[model samples]
Each structure stands twice: as C-alpha cells, then as structure tokens.
Target: MKTIAILFIAFCSTISFGQTEKESDIVINNSQQDDTYRAGETIHVNAAIQGDLVTAGGKLIINDSIYEDFTAAGGELFLNDYIADDVRVAAGRITVDAEIGDDLVVFAGEVILTENAVVHGNLKCFAGNIEIHGDVMGNLDIKGADILIDGTVKETSKIVGEDITIGSNAKFHKEVQYWSSEGQMDFKDSLVNTEAYFDEDLGEEKSELSLISLGIASFSLWIFYVLSAFLVILVLHALFKNAFSNAVEGLQNNLLKSFGYGLIYLLGIPLLIVLALVVIIGIPIGLFITTIFIFSLLFGHLIAALLLVYYYKQKKEKDWGFWNITFLALGIAIILRLLTIIPFLGILLSVIILSITYGALTLNVIHSKKQFVKT
Candidate 1:
C-alpha cells in the first residue's frame, strides 16, 4: 500500500481542484506495491504496481515506477517513469519521458517520445503528430498526421501519415517501410535500404465539392433503405409491441454509452491491428479482424439504435406499439446520420444525440423503469 499511496499523492498534487469537482471529476493516487487506481477526472501516480494499473480518467500523469501493466484513458497524459510491463493509453496528447519494458501502445492528439527514453518492445502509436527522440528495441509502428523519428529504431518500422522526417541521426537495424501523403516514402538522409509503399487508393485530386455531393447522395440512399426496412420490420413485429416499446425507452436512456462504444470501435481497430502484428503469426488474423471491423461499423450503429427503441417501448409503464417505437428510432437514426456529414458542428451534434439516444435505451433494458427513475 505504500507504493499505491505514493502514486496517489503524485497524481493528486498535479490536479487543480479538490473533492468539490464536478460529477464527472475523478482523482486517484496509488502508492503501494500493488497499485489499484480508478478515476473519472484527472490522475497522478507515483507508485509501483505489482499488478496492473487500470484507470479511466480525463487526464493522467504518472511519475512513479510501475512493475506491472498500465491502462489509462484521458485527454492528456505525461508518463515520466519506468514501466516494467506494457502501457496502453488513449488521450489527446501523450508525452513519454521514461523507460518501458514492454510494448507501448497509445492513441492521442500528439505523442512525443523524449530523449533518453527507451522502449524495449514494440511501439504502436496513432496521433495527429508523433515526435520520437528515443530508443526503440523492436519495431516502431505508427499512424499520424506528421511523424518524425530522430533516434534509433533497432528493428523494423512501419508508418502511415501525412508527413514524415527520418532524422540524419536516425538508425534502423532492419527494414523501414512507410506510406505517406506524398504517395511515396523517401529516406531524406543517408540510410540503409528502405522501402516505401504508396496507398493503393491514391488518385488524382478530385474537387472537394464532388466528394461532398457524393456523400449526400449516399446518405439519401441509406435513408430510403432504412425507412423501407423499418416499416417492414414494424409490421411483422406488431404482436411484440410491448417488448419493442421497452427497447426504445432503453435506447433513449443509454444512448451515450452506445455512441461511445461506436467511437471506440472506430479508433480501436487500427491500433489493435498494429499491436497484433508485433506477435509472430498474428498478422493474418489481425488483418482479417480489421476487415471485419470496417464492414461492421455501420451495421453496428444501426443495430444499437434498433435495440434502443425496442427496449424503450417494452419498459414503459404505458406500453407503446411496435410502429411507434420503431418509427421514432428510425427517424432519430436517420437524422443522426444526416447530421454527421455537416463537418465539425455536425460531429459534435451526432455524438450528443447518439449518446442520449443510446443511454436512455440502455437504462430501460438493464433496469426497471421505476428503479431507473429513482436514481
């Protein structure tokens, strides 16, 4: 427990607020031999974990020595310690200034591997930009907007991004294959034989307006198909009106989690693939997984919406008919899809609506309406 306490203190000292923080606010500190920490806001750690360090926070900073694995979720993270096991994190910005004994997998807005840092195993990263000035003993895989490697990569490396810079001092013991916006990879400085592949779908630039128009057309087609299908399903399931009604209510209440699940599915697939490829013979399975993910994303969203509607109607005190709940959910899903195409504001709106819709639905299905209402 000493190590856990130390970890807790280290994290708490960096946070700006106290216990009076918002409902979403969370803070954790673990200073013990076996660190166990969980939070919803910000976390600072200075502990040694004999077991895994699992956390779900808005921001995380670790400055201790951990003996086990660490998993965290946040908007920003700064890790400046020694981790004996693998590290997995999802944040907006991630800065590493320490040593990792195993793999380092991260998703963030920006990831910086500072000088003197060392990664003993593979490094898989996805972000807006990746700046590496450390040592990687195994392969360094990345996907980002801009990627700069100014240190040593002991083994192989693969990257996909908009811009890449392999510093003069950069050393690669094995092959380094990459893809970028230029349609080809270049070893700007002196280096061993490097292979750069181009994106197979790369083509001459088309007008942005053309793509936007096509997107609209696709949306319209989806709307038509959805409406037709919902009507057919509703008519067939008329006898199960109570059950369908309950599902709808559930969806309305728990829409948030469903939306979050969808977003996770979107960002998690590529990262998982990168990690899997590091293990020998896992490459084929990883690629197949990615293909399945791509094919299921839209279908998953649609199903989530449908499930929500069904729960809502069935759980209501005054039961609703199948058509009532089905139409409402279909309408909401169609609107959400349409809104997702509007750019920045649209994205935010879609998240909000989807979250609400799914959240309500989840609540309806998981618990009695009276019990849920009491909470």
Candidate 2:
C-alpha cells in the first residue's frame, strides 16, 4: 500500500509535467508548431523552436534550432544550436553556439563561447569567469571575476575583472579599455589604443556614484512593491491567508514540479494562440483563456507560498502568527518577482512553481469545506 501510494504520487508528478490543458499544475508540450517543450521530472529539449524557448530545471540543453530569441534561467544551460536572434541567458553555467543575429547578454557563474560559435552583434556578459573562442561581429563588454578572450571582436572591447587575458589569437578591431584589481596596468599585447583604469581613486569615485544611484533606485522600487502588496494582503487577509499559506507549502514540497509547470505554460500559450487563429472566433477566446491562465497561475503560486509557511508553523506545533507569515510571505513574493527578470525560462518557471503550489492549496480548501458539510 505504501509503494502504491508512492507510485501514485510519482505518476501524478509525471502526468503533471506533460499536461496541456490542465490548470494549477505544470503543463508541458501544450500546443503545436514553432514551439516544442517537454517538462517532466526534468526538461529536455530535442526539437526545433520557431519562437522563444523558456525552461527551468537542474539542467537545460538546446541541441536544436531556435528561429527566434532564446532566454533561459536555470542551473546549467547549454545551447549548441542555431539561434537566429539574440540570446539572453541567466544561469549557473552558460555555453552558447550557433549564430545570433543580435546582441547576447548573459549572467551566469561560468560562460563559454566555443570555437564554432558565431555572433553577428555585441556580446555582453556578467559572470564569474568567461571564456570566448567564437567570433563576435561587435564589441565584447564583460564584467566578471576573470575573463579570457580568444575570439574575434570586430569592434572595440571593454572588460572589467580581477584578472583579464586577451589571448594571442584574439583580435579586437578598435581600442581596448580595461579595469583591473592590480594597482599597475599591464599592456602585454600590441594594440592601437589601449587604456587602463585602476581600481584606486578614479574607479572608486565612479563606483561610489554608481552604487548610490543603484541603491536609491532599488530602495524606491522595493518600497513601492512592498506597500502595494501590503495593502492588497491587508484587505483580503481573512480570505486569502489559507490559500497563500498552501501555495508556499506546495513550493517547499514540490518546487521542481512547479517549475516544470512554468516551463510548459511559458512556451505553450503563444503556440496555442497561433493555432487558435485557424478559426476567427478562436482568436478572442484563445487570448482570454491565455490571460486567465497566466493570472491564475500567478495567484496560485502566491497561495501556495502562504500555505508552505503555515505548514511550517503546524509542524512546529506553534500558533499561527499573522505577522510572521505576512513578513515572510511578502519577502518571498519580492524574491519571486526578482527571479522573473531572468531571461525566458526564469519567469516561466517561477510562474509554474507558484501555480502548482497555489492550485493544490485551493483544492485542499475546497475539499475541507465539503468535508465540513458531511459532518
């Protein structure tokens, strides 16, 4: 019986990933043409994507062609295909190939541009270490701990790092602007115009100014979001407390499944809308349905998050404290919002995780209500 229960849960987990028309859980490979995705225990992409590709998992590999842009936020992202447009990626490790028509912006722990890779535009990166051996038609703007460039940059280059290396084969057309941690500047290679900035007075002054500006902006945004969220939660605290608590619980219990759901919806809705155009009446319906799905998914995630917090309280055998839940819930909400900015897959995965958490919590509530009626 225990094994059966475990197997049943596992089966639900598997089915949850491949669902197309389901609500509250992850939906994978939902529609037809131009977009293809499979969200299961993990996400595997082995097909062509005419549009953008978004996925979330421990590892994501795109060994196929992407006609449009590709954005991913996850642990490890490997793209060994042809992407016609820009590639914006945020991950732990990012490897890119194929041809990109526009600029490539990446934020990761480690970034690599292999030999066969080609980019028609600029390559900007923020990572711990970046190694480029590919061909970039424009400048390479890199900010990281260590940067190694063995590729071709058709335009100027600006690099800021603790350690910077411009390999022998690496060619930069215009000038080189570098910022380093070492007090002294090293101009090892022959260059037309090479300018180096030290981390002392000049860099320090600029850094202070930039930091102040960033801090102000960040604080303002935070305050606004916090206030808005507080007002909403306060108004509906009684009604939404349970729902919110359940959503958080779901996230804690099944974060990956929630992510899988996001992977499905983020990539599927557009494809469905395109299919809906086959019949004129389907256009409005499709749009409306997509909007509802997106909203519901977001709401569900919020509810799940709340539930997770409440579950923790129950486990500890402590009284439910509204202030504690409120504070933590708001914090999580803010963090999730920040996660959404991560390229294509990040936003979608966040949505999926939240939706599953929220939906499951809602179901529990409805069931409990029904049970009360029987009593």
**Stretches of model 2 off by over 4 angstroms after superposition:** 1-32, 35-41, 183-332, 335-375
| Candidate 2 accuracy as TM-score | 0.51
Top candidate, metric lDDT: 1
> Distance (Å) between predicted and true CA of 200, model 2?
6.8
Model 2 lDDT tens row, 74-173 = 5567888788788876656778876787889886678889998888989888677889999989887887777788877778777777777778777766
RMSD of each predicted structure: 17.4, 18.7
Task: Give the per-residue lDDT digits (tens) of candidate 1, residues 1-375.
Answer: 122222322332222221112434443345566657555455677656677886655567887878889877655688989999999876557889999999998756688999968999999886677899999999988877778889888888877767788887787777766677776666765355654445443222212223432235666556545643353233223222333345454455555565665455456767898898888799987866665554343333344455555554456654655346556767755665566678898767655554443344334444554654688
Cα-based lDDT at residue 7, candidate 2: 31
TM-score of candidate 1 relative to the true fold: 0.51
lDDT scores of the candidates, listed in order: 0.61, 0.59
**How do the predictions measure up, each by TM-score?**
0.51, 0.51
